[model samples]
Target: MADKRYTTEFFLTAAEVNSQREMPLSRLVTTIIDTATAHANKLGIGFDRMISEGISWVLSRLTIDIAESPSVNRTYRMTTWIENVNRLFSDRNFEMTDAETGRIVIRAHSTWMAVNMSTRRPGDLTPIWKGFDMVDGAPSGIDNGGKLLPLSGSDFEMSYRFAVSDIDVNRHVTTRRYIDLITDLWPLETYDSMRISRFEVAFKHEARYGETATASRMAHAESPETATAQIAVADTPCCIARLHFSER
Candidate 1:
């Protein structure tokens, strides 16, 4: 067969929303990854197949930029595709639109590293790329994801006990749930006091479902206005997350 491009569609539901009653940004990321994986699977190139080969796709970093919030009962369309492949990582981009107006609501950019499951380290993606066809154009360069939190320790430390439902098809905690768990650790007072202006995260390791995650905040003395947070399972750092809050 000839090289080809792929895309998939998914709908959002009320259960995915956050306290503000809009679809949670983290859930949006989850949908994107799920759709992209499905597209890859249509070509016989997906995470499960890679895992069977002793390899797995690890989301190393991601950015999600939201323009408007979707209300309950509204159906949205999500599309994802492989934008390009770097030396060791493949870049994936996603777009979400209001199904009725065709207005864009959110966009996301993510980088995934193919790693050897046995060694638990970065591995060449060439083997994986061979299984799928390449797209023709470069990724749309728009910075769709949220900004990274500044280097500061003023952020507070939070903790969450994982639930069984957090597990994905891979039998590990789903990436979206981790975002929820991390953000949930933030004090209710903080959300009431400020608005999250931007957020960024880098996933370094996977936490199995039912594990406990301790999230701690770190602030930069030089710039107390900026802060970052780190979430870990026991002593192993699972994710490095940063959130910027604009004073209300």
Candidate 2:
């Protein structure tokens, strides 16, 4: 039988890096998502196949820890596999390592649900689960809790208008795009002086094209290096995230 895990290599382009010459959090997320999508396609459970059946995979929660960020034009290998699956959701794991030195750069875990595209209701994944090899490894050491509470108050808030480019095959704002919007709330100086050690986000609702969404952030009083962001469209919440930073 073929191994249940999949691995792929990526070379970061100039556009994927920030002024600090390292991969930005948002772009790193996009790479992870892309790697997972490619792995799913190899397993015959990818986005194209799912959408054709009126089912679309929605990311419910994600958590990532970065030990190091690869620089522009550097190559890295991403390995992903299914850690477990239930009727309503599946837990996936990912690891990015230096292609040459074999040092691990990032570890991540994500929870996803398959939903009926038209009804927007969770769909049973039992049929597809039968074909997967259900691995017993979670390199990220993060729980797939899928819980993110809204921030009660914020120090700053920003609103953004979604563009056509933000929409994905599911006809909603892409997960990577949402992360980009959330991280954009921080100024360049923040990125220069601090590094994001951990990031957690929960997707609550879907934002469609041309919708206006607001993002708000509040630093934790107890843990000054930690903060939370709430993203909403109109009055409906879309995503809530927690970011942990450290001096670089």
Candidate 3:
């Protein structure tokens, strides 16, 4: 049987690290998304091929759990595979491990949908399901079905202007950019003292370049270390995320 998994190795560079010398969560997310796309391209069903056929893949949801964060110059390996494909969505899983110690640093799950670019509607994925090598289980112990409940009210609010560089080939703000914007709301001191244990996000609408959007965050009432955030363009909600943190 053909191997259903694809693995890639990476060495964290100075550019990818934060002031604390550890890999930033936002940059790690970018690596994960890029690696997944590269693997799909190798399988002959990536963005370029799908866009040429008038369809494109859109990320709907993502969940990541981190056990440890690798520091600058640290080498790690990431393995990704398709867990399953349904009529509307597909589940992709990832595992990132420390190359030296073989310890799991992060595990993530994501849901994606195939959309008809012209009609701006979701396309049936059954026809292309055969092209993917689907595995039987998820690499991350957590499932991708968790929902991000709406925030009661925002503790902080700010405006964001989308730049040209923020847009992706799909003509919308990139997923990694959105995460960077959300995480930026917190002070650097928070990151210095607290580490994110779990993170979840749901993409609701597309934000185009040159658009001004508002971002808001609300801390959980019971768990002070947990918070939820939402980014919206005018009145239209673009994305929502929940973050869980632990003191270092």
Candidate 4:
């Protein structure tokens, strides 16, 4: 039987770094996502298999906590595994550690479901999943942060028109694009002084190319260092997120 957990070692590059030369939170997400895909493929439950069955995987919820982010030119090893599985969803967790120091840099948890493309509804996982060899370990620190509340108000909004480049194989806006839009809310100074400690997002709807959308952010009153944000198209929210920051 194949190993239940998967690990990948890679070096951070300029393309994956932010203005401060550290891994951007979005890239941290992309790293885990890529590793997850590779693992799923190895387990025979990946995009290729699902698409052949007229379905594809969709992210339901995500939570990430960063202790320290690897800077450009650093090598890191990331491990990911299935934390749990059910007919409707798969729970995944990830931990990234500095390859040289063996220090944990980040931890993340995510939920995903196979969805019928035509109907945009969840498809039964039993037929395809075939069960997992659940890793013998703990999951990420943060839980799969569930559905976030609607934004109370927009301190300010950034407008976007999904373009040809924003579309993916599904012919709709990709989750990465949503991350880009949300991450764009803060200025470079924000990144210089503060780092995202915990980040959570819920993917709610599908937005296609050529659609106009609004990205809004509001500071949380209870947690002055945190912010809640959303991306809505035609007043219909497609993605909502909460971000907690800590001084660097």
Evaluated against the true structure, the overall lDDT of model 1 is 0.70
Question: Which prediction has the highest lDDT against the true structure?
Answer: 4
Pick out the ten consecutive residues of candidate 2 with the lowest summed lDDT.
137-146
The reply for model 4, stretches above 4 Å from the true place, is: 131-137
Candidate 1 — which residues are off by over 4 angstroms? 1-11, 144-152, 163-171, 187-197, 209-211, 218-227, 244-248
- TM-score against native, each model: 0.78, 0.92, 0.93, 0.94
Clashes of 4: 0
User: 32-64, model 4: which lDDT tens digit per residue?
Assistant: 789999998998888988888888888888898
Give the TM-score ranking, best first. Answer: 4, 3, 2, 1
lDDT by residue for model 1 over 1-248, one digit each (tens)?
Answer: 53354545445566766566666657766676777777777757687678777877778887665566655667788777678886578887777788888998767678888888788777777776665466545564566444444333434676777788888777888877777766676666766665555556888777887789887777556765445777788777787776656565
Tell how far residue 15 is off in model 2, in angstroms: 3.2
Candidates ranked, most accurate by lDDT first: 4, 3, 2, 1
Which runs in model 2 stand beyond 4 Å of their true positions?
51-53, 131-139, 143-146
Error of 3 at 87 (Å): 1.2
List the RMSD of every prediction in angstroms: 3.8, 1.9, 1.8, 1.7
Alpha-carbon runs more than 4 Å astray in model 3? 131-133, 143-145
The C-alpha lDDT values of all candidates are 0.70, 0.83, 0.84, 0.86
Candidate 2 has a TM-score of 0.92
Candidate 2's residue-wise lDDT over 1-248, tens digit each? Answer: 55578898888889768898898777878777888788788878887788777787878888998888678888999888888888888888998899988999888998889998789899877776576574656555655444678877889999898899989866889877788878888998998898888899888998999999988999989998989988899888899999999889
